[model samples]
Target chain A: MIAADGGLGIVATQRAVLTENGPLVLASGAQLPHVEVAYETYGALSPSRDNAVFVCHALTGDAHAAGWHEGARRPGWWDNLIGPGRAVDTDRYFVIAANLLGGCSGTTGPLSIDPATGRPYGADFPALDMADFVSAHRGLLDHLGVDRLHAAVGGSLGGMQVLEWALQEPDRIDRAVLVAASSRLTTENIAFSAVARAAILEDPDFRDGRYFEHGVTPRHGLKVARMMAHITYVSELSLAEKFGHRRDTAGHDKRLAADFEVEHYLQHQGESFLDRFDALSYLHLTRPMDYFDPFGAHQGVVPSTRFELISFDTDWRFPTAHSVRIRDQLAARGAAVEHAELTSPWGHDSFLLEPDGYHDRVRAFLS
Target chain B: MIAADGGLGIVATQRAVLTENGPLVLASGAQLPHVEVAYETYGALSPSRDNAVFVCHALTGDAHAAGWHEGARRPGWWDNLIGPGRAVDTDRYFVIAANLLGGCSGTTGPLSIDPATGRPYGADFPALDMADFVSAHRGLLDHLGVDRLHAAVGGSLGGMQVLEWALQEPDRIDRAVLVAASSRLTTENIAFSAVARAAILEDPDFRDGRYFEHGVTPRHGLKVARMMAHITYVSELSLAEKFGHRRDTAGHDKRLAADFEVEHYLQHQGESFLDRFDALSYLHLTRPMDYFDPFGAHQGVVPSTRFELISFDTDWRFPTAHSVRIRDQLAARGAAVEHAELTSPWGHDSFLLEPDGYHDRVRAFLS
Candidate 1:
């Protein structure tokens, strides 16, 4: 357990060897010789083992969905919606969040040492599928000895994971919540992710993803990609409200660098991101999202699980239309599904934020 | 005149040294020691000199506004709207199109030599403003010995230039048409440009904007920037209509490169841009647009030039709100102004395309 200052915002990430059977096979037929899952759990497991709830995180997020670390400045990414009495209500339900496959957090990813070569997988890491992420999550569940989950919840990429799992094991999850997710990435969405990947791959320092040998990383490329993604994550209105045309510099310094407040803010976001994220991880994780076509491939295999799909009005990344499409497809597949387009000034990041009627809706549904 | 084959599409670009008295003063209090303007003309000059219309080129455009150059496959940019019988109606009006001050074309830009150092201006190039573009344009007019114009027309950045010139020289232009333009860039807009600029500046080959001296340029950075900008230039609807989620590669290559048709399209845009555009010029030109707050600085000043502002319904970059703001500002200043939002599948690039009800509106206003 993380040493909590006042028994609040304290959580510890734990690890367990999950692949008991011979090499875990991916959706693409590739196999991982060994798999170690990193996960953080909140609250106690019910005596019936039926009160377990799983949480999936978006791109750039880790297993730390809620609670604060021993020396952290702020709570976990989704601390607002998954605490003692929050939407998920840790007091009554056992909640689990794991670092996804191809992630750079505690989970085994591209940065993990290959048992065969005794080296980081890096560029040699096999292609990932949405099903592969679900497979890893199941491994964690099997290790935890949870037969069934009361509910599963995720947003953005996390939501994609939740969707793939719910579809793969319809009988395991009784209820599922997918927020600001997509059944299929649009051409524009694919284009944005492609450019971000290109930025990292084309960086001179990338060195074919073996930058560890050179004691350097593709910091510039990764920073640029982060800055670009940040622009798309937030709505124009939110940015205008936050930064506007306000320049931080006095007079007309007129340098070609960050002069406007928004520029500096983006630069900070980009620079700070370099500390935690690996370029290879960014490429690997975002690629699966580009190719995620659940409804396309699983048209006939419909899930029996009930679903609540949520979207944000200002989310241009994966707007309400994306949820509506998911709803329609699930409805067409003879599945019971509910959808809501919530009002929010934030864009795609609205799921992580407590927008009007957002937390309340999630809370009411989860209960 | 350009030598024409079948007289179908032919035009020649011409050059003139415009500043006769002294060095041209920039809006930022800096001055260029020398100034030369590249211009192209269509239609015969009226004997009364009252039928001249000036066309301003947007970012990455040259003085080649219309007609085909010898051995070129495609006509000059804006060929649809400025031909002999198009919207501007070159047959009835003598049209003059000039490259902007910081452009990479025939006009003096960062690629131009700093007369003092006997080397390319590069990073040493003085700062630019919307007013500086207007000043250089005025010099072009002085050299042509044309005191007044029937109209001044431009779209996007070109539109911004037209608006600045109209305000600076109110009596000189009878009518001004601004298309998909912004008087002031929003924070989101500046953030985009800032990231684009950072890509070039941070590229290993940039060499502090003196990549020319190193016999290398920021090709990767500039290409990335162009690819990013192209995404904004078109609407998501148009991208969907044009490319959809069509995968171009055979089967599941599953590589991190361009898989979707839109990625290849964006890749082509980025690669082709490297052939014609200079990195320094890209930085210089885009910077001015970020700092373009004409209304903020020139609030007391108002133009008598009749204004016709056109915006595309789908232009998210500088949407109809931008044009509405321009109209409201001009109207508040007691100027005759008209605003219209035209339907177009294209986004910001709609101004350059023959969208429905667009050319007709401009032709009517110009005539």
Candidate 2:
């Protein structure tokens, strides 16, 4: 493993491969002969391994949750929430962040080679759900020989996994934090995802997710999809504040080029996203999020784990109502639950921004 | 002209071409040698030619405002609110609906042949504004020999034109109805439009707006654009009610297909739009809407015309706050203004959907 610092001191991403044991069964009834999970850890595990905390990431996120990778300009996605004295305080908690099963990082995903065919899985990768992701996390836990976790934390789709952890293995998790995430995807949420997936599929270069073999990426389609999703990720107030009516002088020709500051911002966002994300993984990962329904039939068997649910006031994607619902459901089943709806113009992205208030609340709860 | 009945009696779309009458200058300082406006009319003109009610259509609308075309499945966009006894009644007024200058119907637009090259204008279509649309309407009025209008009414982009008409020719428009619109596009509004336009531009087939010559339409790009715009046109509540978690059994294989009802609806909307609309024309019309700011420098010169501004409470696109701003501005200048923010779940499209309350207000105000 290589270590680097992004102001968070030394941290490194490590890999763990599980093979030669037995085929891992997936939620879709498919099996993978072997799997590799890319994970990063901060601080040291306690002698009993009870102080370890696991952090799951949202779509497009990777195992690099904190600190900088070697030669990388930017730190991990959740660097703001982790570190010496940050919300998830690596000073005290042994934090473990791993790329999801269908992510495009070093994790096993559509880009992974199929041992049977000696080729990349591509569209041949089996469908996965939140349960499958939880199972994969279990594999990482087993590899580390961690019998119990002090806490599990996540936001957005990550939050879904946190809830799933509590539900699927109540005895292994002591605390779970879900931020800006719903118990299940809403119709509007599914609609947005559907459109995003369609955008990628319609790209000619996509070639039924076989673009990797053709040496071409569905850049335009993926960018368009990202642009659409980006709109849902931010609040109207944030967009208005950042790029309201600001015209781009160079685009005054009035053709199809971006004329408004918002257009330029969206274009930049779309283009930058293509550099880090995989189109097939985006399609695969988003499916589980749309199908998430952890508390649907298991309402009567709610876990008694401590729960802290946070939501942003301006988050229309997963509104505060979703958090409130989860809190209420857990409370109804005699679970200790704390819910907070913070005010922020960043909307759903507030989970990754406005760290002061969020960190304070998180720190106080965790402690 | 060919007549057809949509339960409100006979109506037909008529075309008027203006050539050899000098160039029509545009707000962008560009000029067209000739232009064509497609229009439809109902009822008879008063003896004094003073009972003319000119109705402007929104972004996707054309001349067919209140009637059925021969062999068409649906009536004009505003059929519910414009009939013999409905709002803006044709019983006592001559109602006129004209396709904007840069529209797809029978009007001159990007799809029209450039007189200079005998080729379609495509991306070369000059930028237009609400002022240009109003001017084109004026040409139609002049051709019809209508000296003045009893009222000029519109909604959304159409509402922008109504406001512009009142500001540009106050004496010619006695009453103005503006629905679900604002004096200028908000920053968030521009952001949505920017994304929509970028989707079309990113399509490989778009070919820098030269797709018409390549024998291929930017179907994917246009569909993606339409899908994004369709989301803004309706409300979250509406989407939830109509397609909440309504999964498609056929799409269970889950390889970038329509898995939810909303996705299917959006796909249909995008596909149908391609048949009736031109992508370049969409780009042309949306720009003027974003640039419209009639009250920017003329705050003190508010038209003294009687104004009826209607908005929907659920419309996030152009919420009631926008209408309130316009009303306050007009009222501050002592203009006669009636404002109503009706409740609806249809969002911005409420103007065309729920007709009872809207029609009552329009009928009473027009009378």
Candidate 3:
């Protein structure tokens, strides 16, 4: 536990291995020994300790799930859903959120030091998958002395982890909630991912993903990739409504010169991401999303699991149809499952936003 | 006159001034003395000359609109629609296809040397508009000794030119056919354009638009831009049908390794573009597209004009609704207009690809 500041305690955790196991071989053939995870906890564990809730974040999110950092204007990314009396209700349940295994945010990732050489893993970091990420989380829970979770909730890649945890450790989770998740990467998804990866690889400054030491990062390349990804994150209708070539009259000159406000927004997003994230981490995490299959090696049906799933109607990236596919699989096996296609214009990001009737549905379902 | 093999003769006009009297100034505050247009003519110009037909091409198209080329597998870009018994019916009407003034395909664009400096214009090239482009075409007609045209026909950006001709130069064109066209750039259109421009602008090798003499070209930027543009050119349904997550079993290993076939396709388009086209010309031509407003200053109403418009039901980029908007605008002004939203899965590119129904409609209109 870290020190408290103001009326709120600023909880932080340093990186540490969850298990003393042999090096796990990665999909890319690299081996990782003693994986470490950085996590934070809030509220108190229930009497049964099964009231522990796990929160997973989307792309670019970290373990910091709530509270203010001195002068921070915003609390945490999921501050709306995880605070006391909020949707997840930390008032009654212990909450845990961790940075993924291959993340740059205080987790054992490409930026972490290699014990064998005392150097940053950089590109040498092994490729990861949803199971590998959850395995690290499992280790973290072991360290916390919590054997089971009341619920696991996530969206986007975070949703993939929730699905994985349900399939890999069925008895450990009482509920699994997935939002805007994909069962497997479609060819178009793979195709777009390839474009993003190529954008980085083609950057001469990328230096074979060793730009960290070169005092130069492929910011432009990363920016391009992020811009591409950002487009997929929102729906066309949302884009039309939010950005709609409505020129920002005050800064209209610069806006028109650059094409439009949306372009400028995307450019800023792409450029800013490079400063905070490692390209290697991006490479490692996205690959797993590309290969994820909850049904495992089975070609016909989803893996048997009792689950609760939700998807947005406008999310073209991971549409409602994908969730329905999983629902059908669970139905085929007669496993308990409840799913819904929420109407929202926010696209894949809708799960995180406050919709008119979304909170009530989540509350009723979780209850 | 140039020799066209097989007893066919083609009259080609080289760099003729289209607008010599008070040439319009570009958006960049640069003034051009005269706009130079390059054009080629096939078949005979009728005695009345009313049989003269102007064929407009889409982005990346050229004056080479028909017949075979040496060592080529396919004919000209529009060979299927402009030949002897085809849509435009070259045997009955003299067809005039010109390379736009701000294009790289043999027209006077940024690739052309500025007489003032004896160097490529690069970023110094004047910013143009649809009006400027139409003015240049008018100059071409005057140079060819033609007073008016039976019809001005085009699709996409070319379709924009056709609409401009009908509205701005009403007396010079008896009829106009715009296929898959928008009167002005939508917010979404400008947004996509911004992504493409950013890809080119952010490339270090772009050298602020002076890449030609730097011994390097921003091929990656150009390719990324093209890849982004390609997504807009095809329909989601078409993408789902043609390239849907189906594994190229033989190429699966390669795809799973670094790049997929789709990646290769995008890279090829990006790199090959630099070999044949001028980057500065791309910037120059597309800039005009942003400013194109057939209606008076983007009032969301099409200008009063005599036109028969055609669009594809599946063309989401410029869908049937876009054509209907034009029709509605024309109706408001009591102008004669006809529109048919053809059914095709080819999306925005249907006008260029689906020649069966497309040619039939054109033939009936022309007759």
| DockQ leader | 1
Error of 3 at A240 (Å): 3.0
Record all residue pairs in model 1 with backbone atoms less than 3 Å apart, i.e. clashing: A9-A68
Kindly list the per-residue Cα lDDT of model 1 for residues B297-344, writing each as its tens digit. 777777889999999988989989999999999999999999999889
Off by over 4 Å in 3: A1-14, A27-29, A248-259, A296-305, B1-29, B246-257, B298-305
Top candidate on lDDT is: 1
lDDT of each: 0.88, 0.85, 0.74
> Ten residues in a row with the worst lDDT in model 1 chain A?
A1-10
CAPRI classification of candidate 1: medium
Say which docking band candidate 3 falls in. acceptable
Clashes of each: 1, 0, 3
lDDT of 3 at B135: 67
Q: Model 2, residue B143: what's the lDDT?
A: 88
Model 3 per-residue lDDT at A72: 64
lDDT of 3 by residue, B254-304 (tens): 222354455566566667776777666667667667656567543443444
Over the true interface, candidate 3 deviates by an RMSD, in Å, of: 3.7
Residue B127's lDDT in candidate 1: 74
Task: Give the worst 10-residue stretch by lDDT in candidate 3 chain A.
Answer: A248-257
Per-residue accuracy of model 1 over A65-177 as CA lDDT, tens digit each: 88987778888898888887778888888999999988999888998998889999988888788888998999899889999999999999999998888888899999999
